[model samples]
Target chain A: MKNRVRYTFILPALILMTIIVAFPIIYNLYMSLHIWFVASGSGPHWNGLKNYIALLSDKRFWNSIRVTIIFTVGALGSEVLIGVLLALFFNRQFKGKDIIKTIFLFPIAATPVAVALIWGMMYNYDLGIINVLLKAIGLPPLLWLADPKWVIPALIITDAWQWTPLILLIVLSNLESLPTDPFESAKVDGANSLQVILYITLPMVKPAIIVAAMIRSIDAIKTFDLIYVMTQGGPDIASENLNLYIFNMGFSYFRMGMASTLAIVLFTIVMAVNVFLAVIRNRDVT
Target chain B: MSKSYIKTGLFYIGIAAITILPLIVFLWMFLTGLKTQMDNLAIPPKIIFSPTLQNFKSVFAQNNFLKYLFNSFIVAVFAVAISLLFGLPAAYAIARFKMHKIGLTLLIARMIPFISYLIPWFIIFRKLRLVDTYIALITTHLIITLPFIIWIMVNFFENVPISLEEAARIDGCSYFQVFVRILIPVVRNGIFTSSVLGFIFSWNQFLFSLILSGNRTMTVPVAVFKFISYEEINWGGLAAAATTITLPPLILTLFIQKHMIKGLTSGAVKG
Candidate 1:
């Protein structure tokens, strides 16, 4: 009786998950094996591996993959770097520190669509504030979202602005919880601040930093709203990440089978990164 | 000593810049919402202007923004409420019984792209004639809120003393009764944190609602796009709409910052 009761406790959630999460994933797999276009008004018919073969040769698909890799690496690299530097700066006591921390939390919590929209306006060529500031500094105002060359970097800046705070918060929390004995000993040994940080602080915070990077990487690869709202994968598909490509395939083109295949590929990529990071984290522990 | 003072002054200046720099976009958004179109489009970007409530008035008067706001509220509330109901007991069971597989399953479910789920959900709901209904939106949002609630609550449940449950059991309290009378009260803070976080996730959710919901159930995030068209974009109206949409989550996050940080970093740091 005791053993069975716990199962009952989980039953409702299990059932809900099966209906909502499990069923969709299975159905997506099944759909990926078919050739169906909803716009054609014909139901799905099995065409095993054709969609996959087509995807293998799809140049647009490959471009999206490239874009995704660049976005992920660029955004995640910057976020971690900036986040760590900011966290180190903030770990010390200062005036209005708590208020500053609270302000940091606002960007992460703000709505993504709204954030994208605000950035879109600010990226405007003629009247936007970013270019205004650039002009004020005596630099040329580049076409931010309108130019293919500058689109990805522009998007990266927006993404970094919004999510860097998350990495900062995670690292800051870890920094606070660390033991003081190591720092005390390092000071007694007459080490400089940079040396102490490089030798002791960073190594101790490695696990937390890895975890933060992993979380940010997973979310960053799946970024959609910001791309969709700001550029809509425009300027000749310059900023179209895999997520946006999959969305266009499914909804705009109504090619459900192709869309499902793209989603599976994305799923595989995300899971691979997740497992890879988990393995590294586990290795650090042992 | 004089050099050290200079360093301290630079440090304060750097900290202030870091803190205030990122917030300029938000400040710009709020200020633009108060500007007339002429002021908004001014080349220098008007830093000082006679602010007007016209944009806010037009957002409500011209677009049916209040309805979208209501839709967002209703969907988020129902989704969070349902997630809490199913997630609390499941979290307790997983924590106490060492159900690690179940916990991992929930985490994987959370990590899957919302687009993957949106494909089948669009098909199923279309067939059921449930598109544009609250039922479809709330149910799909469970894919977000349920996993989030369970993941956060499991951490809270693990921290509770098993002795408390055992004592209740010895006192002739049934498992369900002990869960209700003892564990529920013990992890109320976790419950609050998860609910707030879940509600915010659902509220901010755009893709699911965008594909699944029609005009009748359009959310605030989706509604912001109405101010944009191919012909021309309504800058004042768009700014007002965006500002309105971001306000609730910003306010809620302010109240729960400490708990929210702990919740966000709990599993990531430990594992």
Candidate 2:
């Protein structure tokens, strides 16, 4: 009776998950193995490995992979570095600390689409605040989202602005929980603050940093709303990542099979990275 | 002593700078929302200007934004409420039974790219003639809210002392009775935290809504695009709409600031 009741307790949620979560994933896999286009008014026909074959040679697919890599590396790198630094700076007691921390939470809390819209306006060329500020500071304003060279960087800046705080919050919480003995011993050894931070604080918080990075990477690689709203993978598709590309294939073009293939690839990449990081985290623990 | 004082002063300045830097975009959005179109488009960008409610007026009066706001609210409420309903029991079972595999399954579901699900859902909903319905929107949004609620509440339920359950059992209380009359009251704060966070997430979700919801179920995030057209963009109206859409989550987060961090980090750190 006791054993059966536990399953009963979990039944509703498990049923809902299987229907909503598990079913769709299986359906997506099924779709990926077939050729179908909604616009053609034709049902799915089995065309195993062909969609995958086309994806292997598709130039646009490769471009999207490249763009995703650059965006992920750039955004995640800056976020982790700046976030860790901010966490360190904020570790000490200070005046108005809670208020300051609350202010930091605003970006994380705000709607992503709305956040993208505001950044879109700020990145405007002629009369945007960014350019106006640039001119005020005796610098020439350059095209931001319009220029291919600048689009990824501009997107990265906006991403960093909104998401860096997540890393900071995670790392800061880890830092607070850290043991004091190591730091006190390091101090007794006459190590400078920078040395202590470099050798002691950083190495100690390695697990938290890895976890933070893993979370950020997963979210960043699948970023769509910000890219779609701001650029629509435009300015010559310079900023189009896998998510946007898959969106175009599935929805805009109605190429369901191709889109499913792309999506499967993205899913594989995300899961691979997740497993890789979990391995590193486990290795560190043992 | 003077040198240390200067250092402290610089430290404060540094913290202030970093905090204010990101906030400037929001501040700019708010100020622009209050500006007249002429003032908004002015050269040198008017740092000081007589404000107007015209943008806000136009957003509601001209664009029918109230409908979208209603849609967003209804979807988020129903989604979070249902998640709580299903998630609470599952969370309790997972916590007490040490069902870590079920917990991991939910976590993987959360981690999957939403677009993968969107394709299959779009097709399925289209076949059922359920596209653009509240049912479709609410159901699709479960993918976001349900997993989150279970994860957070599982953590919350684990923290509850089992002795309390034993006490209730000894008093002839059944399992359901103990769970309801005893456990629910203890973790009411967890329920609040998960619900608020879950509501905010479902509220902010854009892609699923973008794909599944049509004109009848248009959400606030998708509605923000109405201010943009092919020829020109309504800067003031866009800002006004963006600012309005951002406020609910922003304000709710402020109320649960401490709990939000605990909720977010608990999954990653402890999982």
Candidate 3:
């Protein structure tokens, strides 16, 4: 009787999860296997593995894969490194630490579309404050967005700007949670600041660093708003991420079949990476 | 020593500026929103330009912007409400049962791209004739928010001493009543944090709203995107529009950011 009563509540929750999350994921996988298109309103014609084959042959698909990698790796690597350093600084007892933290949190929670627009304006070559400051310092003004070489860097910079506060939050919280006895023991052992940090601090925070990296990497690969808002993957496909590329294929040109295939590839990559992380994370747990 | 202090000072200041640039730009957008088009785009970008409410008038008066705001409110509200309604029992079960697989599935949901499901959802919603309905948008939004609520509340529920809930169950109170009255009283802040974070995520979500919503259901981001359709975009109007849409989230974060960060980094870093 006791077990049966408990099972009732779990059943409803299970049904809701299946309807909302599980069903859609299954449907997405099924859709990836077909040749569906926009507004056709007609039922999909099954073309087993054709979508996958076409995706393999498509050069633009490969180009987008390359771009997606650069975007994800570039954004994740920089954000975590810079985020830890910032988190450490913020953790230090300093004047205005709270206020600086408040300021730091602003970009992380602010609407992405809006932040993208603000950065878009700031990156304006002529009227933007960045170029003006550079010219005032007697430096030559470079085209921030119009130039191909500078575009992805600009996107990565903006992403790091908004999201480093995220990793910083995680690291700073873990830093605060560290027991004080370790530092005291390290000091007794005649360790300097750098050695203590290298030995005690970094290892202690290794779990957090990995966790932060996984979370950031997950979203980094799917970054759509900032890329779309800032560059629209422009200056000759300089910053076309998988999400934005899939978006363009589906809606912009109405290639839903191809778009679904891209999504499948993206899903596979995310799962593969997530599996790798889970294994490492699981081992850490054990 | 003084030279090293100067170097450290320079480096710290540089990092601070980089971190603060987006906020400064946001302020500039707000200021520009209050200025005329010509002044907004002036070569020097006038800091002292004459302020005007013309853009606000156009935003509110012309764009039917209030409707979009209302839509955001409605979608975010119901979606968050529903996520809580369904997620509570599951989170409680997960916490109580130590159900790692269920928790892991929700975790993977967080990591999956929204586009992976978009293709099918658009099809299903369209076929159901539910496109442009708040119901369609909100329920679909649950994909993003439900997991968030469950994930955050898992910690909150875990934090509660089992004895309190167990004692209630042993008493005359039914399990449901214990959940409603006793357990809820303890986890109010957790509920608030999850609900608010969920609200913010649903409110700011773009791609779902893009395909799911028609003109009547258009969101702030989609509305902002439409301004660029013409060969010519009114720079002042666009900036003003962006500023208008950015304000609510900014103000929400300004107050609730501590919790927002807590929610963002919850399980990622084991603090």
Candidate 4:
């Protein structure tokens, strides 16, 4: 009876997870193996490994992979770099620190779709404040979202703006709880400020930095809403990452088979990245 | 010491400069939302302008902003509530019993890209004729909220000494009673933190609502997307709509900044 009751406690959550996550993942794999079209009256017919084979040769798929790499690296790299700098700065005692920290929390809380629209306005070619500020500073106005060359960078800037603060929060808190003994001893030994930071602080916070990096990387790979609202992978598909590519394939074009195939590929990439990070994290802990 | 104080002051100034620049973009959105159409498109960007509520007026009167806000609220509240209902016990069980498999499963659900679930959800909801209903949106949002609640709550549950529950059990408390009467009271703050985070996530959800919700049940984030479709894009109205969508979560963050940071970083430090 006791065991049955304990099982009941966990059963509801398990059922919901199975229905939502596990079932969909399995169904998606099944859909990827067949020719399924939303518009066609005919039901799906089995095609063994056909969709995957086609994806191997598709230029669009390759372009999306390339774009995903550029975006993931650009966005995650900057967020971590800037986040560490900000965290270091904030670690120092200062007046009104809490207020600034609170303000920094806003972007993470703001809705991404809304933030994207706000960015879309800021990047507007004709009447955008960005170009206006450029002109004021004696520089020529550059198309932000309009130019294909700049679209990916534009998305990266937006992502970095929102998420860099997350890394800041993580590292800042970690910095707070760090033991001060090493710093005190290093200071007693006549270590300079930069040397102390480079040798002492960096090593202490390395694990937190890595954890923050992996988390941000995972979330960054699945970016959709902001990209969807900002460019929709337009300007000749210059910014079409894998997530958006899968979305367009399934929803806009209604190619269920190809979309499912792309989704499975995306899933594998995400899982591999996660597993790679997990292994590193384990090594760090040990 | 005085030289170090000056250096610290400069550092604060620099931090403010870097942090405040991106915030200016948000400030500009709010300011532009109050500008007249011509004033919004003015050359050199209208830094000084008479603010007006006409944009907000139009966003509400011309567009159905309230309906979407209501829909988002309803979906978020119920999603958090249901997630807590199922997730709390599961978290407790995992924490007490070392149910590693269930815990890992929840983490996997959290880790996977949400896109993997979208297509199947679209098909299933459409077939059931449940598309655009609150029931459908709430059910779908559980995917985001459930795993989150379980994971965050697991940390808090582990923090509560098992000895407390053990003492309660010895005092003639049933497992359910020990959970309800003792454990829940102790973890009320965790519940609050997870609920707010879960609600914010659900409120900001765009993809599932984009595909699943129709005109009647569209959410604020998806509704804000409609302001830019193939027509004369209304800059003033779009800013107003965007601000409307942003303000709630922003306010929520301000009030719960401490808990929000704790909840967000709880998993990071341990990981």
Q: Which candidate comes out best when scored by DockQ?
A: 2
Q: Kindly report which residue stretches of model 3 are placed more than 4 angstroms away from their true locations once superposed.
A: A39-42, A282-286, B1-19, B230-233, B267-271
Q: For candidate 4, write residues A1-286 as lDDT tens digits.
A: 6777678789888888899889999999999998888877677789989899998899999999999999999999999999998898789777788888888889999999989988988888888777777888999988999899989999999999999998998889889999999999999999999999999998888888888887888788888998889999988788889999999998998888789889899878877887887788778678
> Which regions of candidate 1 fall more than 4 Å away from where they truly are?
B1-3, B267-271
| CAPRI band for model 2 | high
lDDT of 4 at A76: 95
Worst 10 residues of 2 chain A by lDDT: A127-136
Docking class of 3: medium
Give fnat for candidates 1, 2 and onward, in order.
0.77, 0.80, 0.64, 0.73
- Cα lDDT of model 2 by residue, B144-230, tens digit: 899989999999999999999999899999999999999999999999999999889988999999888888999999888655653
The C-alpha lDDT values of all candidates are: 0.90, 0.90, 0.80, 0.87
Error in Å for residue A138 of model 4: 2.2
Winner by lDDT between candidate 4 and candidate 1: 1
Model 1 Cα lDDT, one tens digit per residue, A126-174: 8888899999999999899999999999999999999999999889989
Q: Write the per-residue lDDT of candidate 3 for residues A67-180, one digit (tens) a residue.
A: 889878889989999889877666666566667777777777677887787778778887877788888899988787788788888888889888887788888878988999
Candidate 3, residue B256: lDDT: 67
Model 1, residue A131: displacement in angstroms? 0.8
> How does each model score on TM-score?
0.98, 0.98, 0.93, 0.97
Better of 2 and 3 by lDDT: 2
